[model samples]
Target: MSSSKNTLLIILAFFSIYVIWGSTYLLNKIAVSELPPFMLASIRFITAGLLIFIIAKLMGKSLAITKRQLINTSIAGFLFLAFGNGIVVWALKYVDSGFAALEISAQPLVVLILMRVFQGKKIEMMSVLGVILGVIGIYLLVSQNEVVSKEGSILGMVMIFVCMVSWAAGSLFVGKADLPTNYFVNTGYQMLAGGLMLLVGSLLFSESWSSPNVWSEKVQWSMVLLVIFGSIVAFTSFNFLLKRVSPEKVATSTYVNPIIALGLGWYFLNEVITAQSIIAAVVLLTGVYFINTKKKLVIFSRFHK
Candidate 1:
């Protein structure tokens, strides 16, 4: 591809992931208002999975995979979607969407620590500083009067933290695991597996299955947006960027997503952005920037040497 086209595609992919995925936090908050979280997540992933699977097949992409690959993908799916996303959806019942986004912004810090502990990766000083700042930011965010006053909000924040850990672990696992060559096909399989797990959880929790008529128009529309823009467009773009750009560059979405989510939540849902939250967001995003960019700077220095 020409340089211009490559740049354009990168910009488009970045926008998709940054804007669409960020918006999903607020949309999910809206969706779980009426629907059970597990059921709603299950339906969203299953529907998107089946649709994407069919589309991939129609496009001549093979869905063939070894048993081991299937198992690994399923495990990743369970971790990333069932636990990570499903739990957040449940927590949204108690937490503000903007607050949840702020909490999730620490994912890079979690992944950084995990990589060092499990993989024995060398941590840069900047990354370490980033982690420290991120933790401080989170402490400030959760210590606010708003979060403490709300019943169960503390537990909800803790659950969101766990969600980030699960997502980070799943991301690391998928990076090393054997899976389908086609990104869309692989994503479909992952979604299907995750959706099944969510369905099982729904059953175990005995979530009420309300009729479609009972769902508000906003909830219904939010679900549609999540399935289409959040899952299909943003996810596909994310996978595309992973292949074309440096992973650190692609990870910049972490810094951008929270801001977008905060804005959307404030504008649409009247979610309050407290002074503490704003300070935390700034600190958290700065940490994320350092974590992602410091390694690239190191690499550039090495090349120059």
Candidate 2:
């Protein structure tokens, strides 16, 4: 592809991950209001996974895989989707979508810590400082009287934190695990496994299921959007961006997503954005930016591996 074409494709890919994924938070909140969280997640992932798997097969991608690959992929899927996504959906019942998004935004920071602890990666002072600031930001964001007004809110915040940890762990695991060679096929298997796990959880919990006749239009539309735009399009774009751009640059979506989620929540759901939350967002995103950016300062160079 020409340089101009490549740039345009990159822009489009960036837009897909940044906007579509951000919007999923709000849609998830809406979906969970009517459906059980695990069931909702299960449906979304299963539908998306089946569609993607079909498309990949049509494209001549092999669906065959080893037992070990299936096992590893299943484990990754459980961590990333069954817990990471399912719990966040449940938490949305007690927290604002924007607040959940903000809490989940700390995922990259968690990934950094995990890498340092498990992979023996060298951590720079600035990265450490950024992690500290991110923790402080999270503290400030959740410490507000309005935020913890309900007892469930505290639990909700805790669940969101767990979601971040799960997602980070899954991401780290995927880097080292044996899986399908085709990215789309691997992702499809992960989704299918995770979705099945979630469905079983839903059954164990005995979650109530409303009939389709009673399902609201908004809930139906939101679920459809999630399967199409959130899962399929955004995921494809994210993998595409990983191949085309620096991982750090692609990770910029993490910072941008919260801002988009906050705006959408405030506009559509009339979610309150307090002064404290704004300040916290600024502090948190600044810390994230510093962590992701490569510094040329001499002091920072000393920590490089």
Candidate 3:
């Protein structure tokens, strides 16, 4: 690829991840109102995964994977989608979509800590400051008496925190795991694996399944958008960027997603954006910026050395 083409592709990919993905918090929130969380997620991922395979096959890409790669993708699927994403969808029933997005914005902080805990990676000074600010930001977001006092809100917030952990763990795993070389094929496997597990979860929970014809118009639209743009387009862009750019730059989605989610939720869903939520967003994104900036510096030093 020429430099110009690469730059253009990078811009497009970043837009997909930043805007489309940011909008998915609201999209999932909309769909989950009329559909069960696990069921909603399963349908979205399964449809997207199958579509990916079809697209890949049409483009003459092989979908074959080693057994170990399949297993790794399956594990990532469970961590990133089944548990991490599904439970957040479940929590949308209780929390405002904007609030949920804001909470998830702290994922980089969690990933940072998880690296230290699981891999014995040294926490640098910048990251330590990030950890401190993340704690404060999280407290500001979750400590609202009115927010948590809502029915099931506490549980929702706690479960979202768990989802963050699962997502962060999945990130760590993907960094080191052996998987398909083709990002599209790799994403397809993970989505399929995650969707299947989500189906099992829905069955285990005895959640009612309804036909799309019975779903509300808004929900149907939300599901379509989630499956197409959110899952297939934006997620593939995510994997693409992960390979093409620095990790810190890819992590910039963390800074933009919540703002987009907050705006979309407040505008479309009439979700309240409390003053404290604004404070939390600032503190949280700043912390993430500190961490990402430090990361970029570290990578630059390594490359130059």
Candidate 4:
């Protein structure tokens, strides 16, 4: 591809991860409204993983991997998808989609703190400030009387935090784990593993299983978008941008996703955006920006050794 075309691709790829991923919060909120959360997640991931494998095969890419790689991918899959994402979807049943997205915007802050605790990595001055602001941001975001007073909303918020820890730990694990060289193959394995785990969880939880034909039209469309755009295209674009652009530049999605989620939720679902919530987003994203002020900061980009 020519330079101009390459630049265009990069721009489009960024858009995919930013807008598409940001939109997924609303999409999940929609799907989980009618479907069982675990079942919904399993269906989305399994479908995406299978589609990825098919696409890779058509591209003549190898899908073979060693046992250790498979194991690592499974671990990552559980942490990142089965538990991490699955629980968030479950939480969406009680919390607003935009609220969940805004809370997750503090992910880099959590990742930074986890690095310190697990790997003995030093928190630089800017990151320390980021962490402080992130804490305050979280408090403002979650302490809303109206939001928390809702039945089960507090538990939902707490579970979402746990999901953050799961994703942070997963990011740390993926930073060092040996996996397939091809991003598509690696993602396919991870998604499949995660999906299988979610299926097990669904059965254990006794979540009702229903056929797709029985789903509402809006939910069916939402599921389709989640599998195709949110999981596959957005995630692929994320990895692609990490390779082509600077990690810090790619990490801007961390800042953009919440705003997109908030807007979409408000417009489409009539989810209210509180004044405090808006303030929390500003502080939280600003903190994330400060955390990335250092050149080559991880920003969830394979920071572990």
Clashes of each: 0, 0, 0, 0
TM-score of 4: 0.91
TM-score, per-candidate, Cα-based: 0.92, 0.89, 0.93, 0.91
Candidate with best lDDT:
3
Question: Which portions of model 1 miss their true places by more than 4 Å?
Answer: 1-8, 241-251, 294-305
Given candidate 3, what's the lDDT at residue 11?
96
Looking at model 1, report the run of 10 residues with the lowest lDDT sum.
Answer: 296-305
Query: Could you give candidate 4's per-residue lDDT for residues 94-199 as a string of tens digits?
Result: 9999999888877777777777888777777887888899899999999899798999999999999899888777766676678787878888998899999999
lDDT of 1 by residue, 201-305 (tens): 999999998765778999889988988888777777776665565444455687688899999999999999998899999999888777767565465233222
lDDT order, best first, reads 3, 4, 1, 2
What C-alpha lDDT values do all the predictions have?
0.83, 0.82, 0.86, 0.85
Q: Which candidate leads in TM-score?
A: 3
Q: Candidate 1, TM-score vs. the true structure?
A: 0.92
Candidate 3: worst-modelled 10 consecutive residues by lDDT? 296-305
Ranking by TM-score: 3, 1, 4, 2
Q: What lDDT tens digits, residue by residue, belong to model 2 across residues 70-91?
A: 9998998898789988899999
Error of 1 at 91 (Å): 0.3
